[model samples]
Target: MGSLVYREELEEDKNSAFTWEVQANNKAYNRQFKQKAFLCWWRKKYKRNAIHTAKYNVFSFLPLNLYEQFHRMSNLYFLLIIVLQGIPEISTLPWFTLFAPLVCLLTIRATRDLVDDIGRHRSDRAINNRPCQILVGKSFLWRKWKNLCVGDLVCLHKDSIVPADLVLLASTEPSSLCYVETADIDGETNLKFRQAPTITHHELTNIRKMASFQGKVVCEEPNSRMHHFVGCLEWEGKKYPLDSGNILLRGCRIRNTDTCYGMVIYAGFDTKIMKNCGKIHLKRTKLDHLMNRLVVLVSFPKSLLWLRFNPWPGIFLMLQMWPKKSY
Candidate 1:
């Protein structure tokens, strides 16, 4: 019996090492494939003719350098508006009045800059590019130091930002599994089990499991709630219960496991996860642009109307339209 146990242990160690080697080779191949594809695409898109067209085209609003510099200066323009508003007497000066249109132009530019900034930050956070702390094993540290890959096994603790979506591989003995707050994906506040597959889809179209964290988490402050929904998959087979250390996809809720390893089938922009993120970003950008246009359309005519009826007409209109409910 002792001999059998020793042989089994040796076999398990060999298997584990073999799996790790396979994973490493796969990662390297994928990295090279992606790099080559990117270079090919870049060369095709930025050929000599493309550069010339972009430069001399009347529709080209500005050169890339000027556009970037203008964007960086947008915040300063916004600050100038606030300063100008505080001093009403300055508006009466001849020079100030003459330059008021220039100031208005600057304000518009600043507003655009503000919107762009919000969009960029949102995109960065959605894709997990921003700096945040995560648990690798015994230590709690920021992800800035370690370069995480898609298929790598990760250990997450309570309150740590999940570096990437992962599957629960193993839990601490005695079932002391860390509770994960998945409010970013699910709308409910309750903690979910990180154990085996409880839910399975029947349709092959729904067999491909996907977990997305792009949606907004709407909950109260502090332990704020997150919003998550079931993902669609396309597989055909009877749903079997997964073991404790079974593979899980990114964005999965690992309930009872302290450590988990997900086979990184998808990573970067090619993954369904990144596609969903891109969709959310596009939606937010469109909404923000529409709101800004609406505000300007409403305000522009009002300002012009005020200018048209200034002096005597302005005083009479103000007196007649003044509210009498000053109590």
Candidate 2:
């Protein structure tokens, strides 16, 4: 037991020494990147030079917007009739008159969606504009959230939103306890607590003291499960098991501490937030289903009824022949 105690103390001393050295190295690295950030500012005058590339554009953007409208069965049925307007016989004055009103209504709806989509783009800009901490020597420097990358060390301040999925290392709490609010993502208001790796959680919490902290994290690739991370933090020849308990997810707001130090493990779309929200699917209501059925049934018999028989009387007779619902 005495030998084991002696060995533990020796390892702690070695880790502390290494932390200082890492701090020195970090300061040098920060100085080098400072010049590059300024030079690129001239190229991107409005947005940050490091902004994440968007997947949407004017050409593809319009088509995708129209595609959402196309997903509705009602819209499809209405468009099918309008398309037949190409035929001279089908292009009657009454049918053309009805087409105008329908086109106006659809135009109004598309405009509303365009406005809503603009709002989403603005929100995305706000999120990416938020500041993220990048470790520099014994201190942390703030940078745009879009500049954050995997394996970077970041400091989360109280009430600040997390910019990426990171592995907690140390916190203001002596026992390495960190609290975060996840209401934005999970819809829960209560704060949740996260712990740092057991092996090095106690080494240091002060930014200066932990400066030399050089650690290697081995974790599983990004996955859909929010609370199923697996990994280990290796520091100073010792390994600490890492799991969901040690992860601070992006978009979660930090709480109840001056700051907590963490290492970035995932960023951008690879974060759990994006994984959970797979795609935007337009929902179809019961009305849409009915419209689709009506389109199919009417199209096949339109020639027989409209050309030979009286359309109104034939439609009425068919309605009467069908079973009536009793409330």
Candidate 3:
């Protein structure tokens, strides 16, 4: 019985032969990397970088920012009109003269916003439509990046922004050494170097080898933390421990290598980039609120002046003190 137990322990050690562990005790349970585990983890945590789909449609007259402009400018214009309209001197003048400049500003702002929305739509369409290589049953096939699924093996090359978070498998560089530019995502200008597993370094030597590749990679659960990765690549009864050195995040540019191959670990919005972004809400500054209060405070003295002096002359005097909306 003791001999049998020792044999089982030795076999377990043989299968779990890994070089480094990123986390001391948080390593995945001792199980072979499986397709089901990859799919289950991806479906549970993955998200795509997507703008608000409900907003900026061609049918809508107002772009996303138009409402914000209205809140900033139109609201102030109406408040001023309400206070000044009751003045007898201003009421005698053309009412359109009071609002014409404000109307023009609003029109110009809306036009600029619409153009920006159109540009955004064009960019989104282009990215979603761009093609990448995927292994399709012993041959490589071109597939759109947007439709990429977890566990899909992708072929990457120089100067292209990676579309999804991936595990390094093989690269064209000797010893599977690759470098990438992460300036687009984390604002790092330096080219960061990455490595494929030393064990699987020679597996993809040519197009035929890459096209015929198949493997399962098990990694840490998807997380919002940038610059942290814990996982492993496994194939043919071997497990290779992986860290940030063996990972390529989405939005990073491949550089200093002709081509590389990776397995998509997380796709869509569940990626690190999308997960780390804060909520889509604006935070007004202290100065903004102070300026709004200043307008109302200044309005009080103007109204008092009209009450103190004759209403007609005081009305015109008060108009000169009016401050325009900041936005």
Q: Assess candidate 3 and give its lDDT.
A: 0.69
Model 1, range 1-327, lDDT digits (tens) per residue? 999999996665444321211121133443432223454562211011000101212233235423533343333443455555555443334455535765577567646755665565555445454343333433334654125554333445444445443333334423323455455554556875544233321111110122211111111111111122122211233323333233333344445444432323233343323334433211235655566566566666776887787666657656765678766
lDDT of 3 by residue, 1-327 (tens): 999999996665455344221211111421122333454563323333343322367666555555676555335756478457656556765556766776677789778767876776787778777788877766668988777766667788899788788877789888898899999888989999999988667766666765555556666556686787666766678877778888889889999999888877777665788678645454467776776677767766787776888776666667765766887
Q: Comparing 1 and 2 by TM-score, which wins?
A: 2
Question: Using TM-score as the measure, which candidate wins?
Answer: 2
Which TM-score value belongs to model 1? 0.38
TM-scores across all candidates? Answer: 0.38, 0.69, 0.62
For each candidate, what is the lDDT? 0.38, 0.69, 0.69
For 95-184, candidate 2 gives per-residue lDDT tens digits of 666588777877887787767767777777888888877876667898888776565678788998888888888887868899999999
Instruction: Point out where model 3 deviates above 4 Å.
Output: 1-45, 48-55, 59-66, 77-100, 186-189, 202-221, 234-239, 274-290, 300-327
Ranking by TM-score: 2, 3, 1
List the candidate 1 regions with Cα displacement exceeding 4 Å: 1-26, 32-103, 106-112, 115-142, 173-179, 196-263, 268-274, 279-327
Model 2, poorest ten-residue lDDT window? Answer: 16-25
Candidate 2 stretches with Cα past 4 Å from truth are 1-56, 72-84, 89-91, 94-99, 204-212, 301-327
